[model samples]
Target: MGGTDCGAYRAGLGVYAIGRLAGAEAAELFAHLRGCPPCRAELAELRRVAELLAHCVPAREGAGRGPRTGASRTGLSGACAYGSRGPGRSR
Candidate 1:
């Protein structure tokens, strides 16, 4: 929300932080980040969220150890289990 020009780049920041953005789009975002302080700040915050999300995932049972059970895997665990806390919110 820094500016109208930043909306597009901000939209992709989440994917970029998670290492999903690639090719021309990522290259463009990187270049924009160099000149856009607000985008850079948002990118840093998104990276933190990405890190927290990574740790919130539950480890797969029997991963390479044995057969998996019928238990469904939701992927979300720990911090994300209760849903997103959003910016500045806490448990």
Candidate 2:
């Protein structure tokens, strides 16, 4: 199992994250994930992005429809989502 091809295992991640992989296959992928930090991180980020995508509203039907210029949903003009960074704010 340790020598299995990474591409095949990586391909399973999307299905596995959603609990759609068959039981034995899921277990196999889990074993691979346990030993592979890069793969594990990729899977984690994929899951997070999936959650973010789920909350996204559909685009309005118009030529100019787009996310408002630079504002995140957080309403902070240029501030990062978390908060201001003192001196860094002057940069």
Q: Output the number of the TM-score-best candidate.
A: 1
Tens-place lDDT digits, model 1, residues 60-82? 86655753332224554545644
| Clash-forming residue pairs, model 1 | none
- TM-scores, all candidates, are 0.60, 0.53
Q: Considering every candidate listed, which one attains the maximal lDDT?
A: 1
lDDT of 1 at 65: 70
Error of 2 at 8 (Å): 1.5
lDDT of each: 0.79, 0.74
* Superposition error at 86 for model 2 (Å): 55
Cα lDDT for residue 45, candidate 1:
96
Off by over 4 Å in 1: 1-4, 59-91
Write one digit per residue (lDDT tens) for candidate 2, span 24-84: 8899889898888878888898788777865885655784455564555456564554347
lDDT measured at residue 27 in model 2 versus the true structure, 0 to 100: 91
lDDT of 1 at 2: 36
Q: After the best TM-score superposition of candidate 2, give how far the Cα of residue 55 lies from its true spot, in angstroms.
A: 1.6
- Checking candidate 2 for backbone clashes, the offending pairs are none
What TM-score does model 2 achieve against the real structure? 0.53
